[model samples]
Target: MFAILIKIKAMRVLRITFFLFINAFYANAQYDFEKYPSIEYKDYDWETVKSDDGVTHKVIVPDFYINSESLILKINYYTEEAKDSEIYISGIKYKEDIPYTPIGLSSLRIADVNGDGLKDIKIISYYMGNGLASLNVKVIYFFQQANGGFIKIAYEDKMGDNRLERDFDGDGNFEIITMKIQGHKNHNYWLFNIYNFVNGKIENVNSKENYPIMVQILNRETFKITSKLSRQEMKQYQVNNLENYNN
Candidate 1:
C-alpha cells in the first residue's frame, strides 16, 4: 500500500512539472502579428515604372511636405528574376550600389542641399529580414540631387538605426544624424553619430556610446520614443519603428 502511494505522489509531481513546461513554452513563443490591428495597413497601390535599361520597377510615391522641391519615389526591382531583390530611387541614381538590403523603403524628405531652393531628396530604408524565423533588421539611407537623382548615404545592420537630414548644428547644409548598435550581446547599446556633407561627400562626426535602440524624429529638431525591449512589444515595436521612418 505504501509503494502505491509513493507511485501516485510521483505521478502527481510529474504532471505539475509538465504543465509548468507547457506554460513557459507558450509564453515565450515567437511574436504573433494578429494581436495588433493598427500595424496592418491595407496594402497600398504600387506604381510600375520602367527604367532606360528595360527593367520594370515597382514604386510608390508617398505624400510630400509642403515645401518639397522634387518628387521622391520608392522603387524596387529584381535584377534577372523576382527572387533576388534590388531597390533604387528615381531621379537620383548612385554611381554604384550601396551595401545593405532594406525590407522596405519609403517616405522621402525633399530639401535644398546647397541652399539653392531647388529640392534635394533624403530617403529612409527599413531593413529587416524574414519574419517569425531568425530575422534581421537594419536601415539604409539615400540622398538626392536638385536635378532629380538619388545617391546612397549609409547602411546599418541593426534595428532602430536610422538617418536624419537636418542642420542640427545651425549650419546651412543638411547634416546626417544616425544611430548604430556597437556590440553583439543581449545588452548591446546604441551609438549616435552626426555627419556633414561637404562638396558631395559624407563624413562621420563624433560617435560613441549606446542608446535605447529606438528613437523617432518628432520634427525638424527633436526625437521621440517608439519602443523598448520586451517580448510582448516586439511586433508593435517593429511596426512603430517602420512607420516612424516612413513619416
Candidate 2:
C-alpha cells in the first residue's frame, strides 16, 4: 500500500511540472501584434518628379504637416530582367528653396540592412516646431524593393529630443535607439528605448528608465540592465556607451 502511495505521489508531481513548463513557454512566447496599437499610415498623393541627381522619383506630400516643403520621394531602379523595374521609397525632405536644413533627399543614406548585399535607403525626417522650446517629432523610414515598388520594412517614430542608430548586437543590421524626456520642467526623467527590426516591423526589444544624474546601459545579448552616475542633463544624454551595451 505504501509503495502504491509513493507511485501516485510521483505521478502527481510529474503532471504539475509538465503543466508549469507549458505555461511558462507560452508566457515567454514571441510578441503578439494584436495586443499592441495598430499602425496607421498617412495618405499622400504621389507624383513623379525629376531631381538634380538625374534620377526620376515618385514623390508625395503628406498632409500631416502644413509645410509645403515636406515631401516624400522614391528612387526608381531597373530590374535584372531588363523589362521590369521597381521604385524604392526614399525619404521626406525639403525643397531646394526652403531655408530650413534639408534632411530627406539631401541626407539619404544607403546600407545593406538584411545582409542581402542589396543597398537599401534610410530616411530620417523631423518636424521642428517654432524655436528651441518646442518639442521635435522624428520619423525614420527604411525601404526595400518589392512588387515593382518599395515597401517600408521598418519604421520608428518618437517625440524625443535625440536618436541614434548602430549595430547593437554585433549583427549586421542596425538598431534604432531613442532618448526621450518624460517629465516636466526641471524635474525631467530620461526614457531610453532600443528597437530592433524583426519580422517586418520595428519592435521594442528593451527599455530603461534613468534618473537625471546617471546613465543606464543594457547588454544587447542578455539585456541585463546596469547604471552609472554621469550627471548628464536629460536632453544631453546620448548613446555614448555602445561598447558596454552591444554584444
Candidate 3:
C-alpha cells in the first residue's frame, strides 16, 4: 500500500490549497458597500444659489479662462463652503491670473461633468492641513474630450470631506462621492466610485442601481469604511484604479 497512497495524495493537496485560499479571499476582498456600487441615479438635492452677485464662475475656454477681472471668491460651487472660494487663471501655464492653488481652500466648477456632451473641470479643496488624515478633502476633475482632450480625475481623503453630488441621483446624472485609495500603506481600503463619460473615456459604471448612493457616500464618510477598515492609517481604501489613480 504505497504508504496509503502517500497519505491520500497529501489529503488531496490540502483540499486544493484550501479552495484556492477561499477564492483569493473573495477576490481581494475589501471595497464593500454591498460590493461597491457601480452606478445609479436619482438623488439630486442641489440648488442653493446665492451666487455672489459679482463673479459666478463658469470658466469659459478661450484657451483656458476664468475671468471677472480674474475671479477671487466669486462663489457658486453649490454656495461655497469650508473656506469659501477663490479662482484666477488665464490660459494656464502661459500664466495670466496666476494661481493654481490646491491642498485646501478652493472651489471652482464647470458643468457637463462626465455627461460627455463636453464641458468639464472641477477643483474642490478644504483643509486638514494634510497632517495625514483627520478630515482631509481634495477632489479634482478635468474631463473633457472630443479630441481637444482633457481627462484628469482625482480623489483624496484620509478621513472625510469628499463629495460632488451634483444631481446626485435624481437621474439628471452626475455622481461622485469620493474617499478611495489603494494598496501599500499597509494595504489601504475604503472606496466608492461611479465615474461617468463612458463612450469616450472615464469608465467604471459600477452598477446595481448604486445601492443607495453607496449607502449615502459610505454613511457620510468621516472615518467610516467600517471604521477605517481596521485603520493602520486606512491603507485599505480602494476604488477601481483606472490605473491606480490619485495625484
Q: Model 3, residue 116: displacement in angstroms? A: 7.3
Q: Write one digit per residue (lDDT tens) for candidate 2, span 1-247.
A: 9999999999999999998998777555422112222222233333444455333435554331223233355544232231232333324322211112223222444455544333444544343446533344334344443322334532223443223354545565555555444443444344555556556555655432232222232232111122333434432544433211211
lDDT (10s digit) by residue, model 3, range 27-75:
5654333332233322212222343442233333332322223312222
- Highest-scoring model, TM-score: 1
lDDT of 1 by residue, 1-247 (tens): 9999999999999999999998777565421111221111122344555565434334444443334432435444445332344554545434323223333544444455534343454444344346412223333444444454444544443333223344544455554445443332343333334455555556543221122233333233223333444323322212112212321
- Clashing residue pairs in candidate 2, if any? none
Candidates in order, TM-scores: namely 0.42, 0.39, 0.30
Global lDDT of each candidate: 0.41, 0.41, 0.43
Worst 10 residues of 1 by lDDT: 32-41
Give the C-alpha miss distance for residue 23 in model 2, angstroms.
55
In order of TM-score, best first, we have 1, 2, 3
TM-score of 3: 0.30
Model 1 residue 151 lDDT score: 48
1 versus 3: better TM-score goes to: 1
Give the lDDT of residue 40 in candidate 3. 31
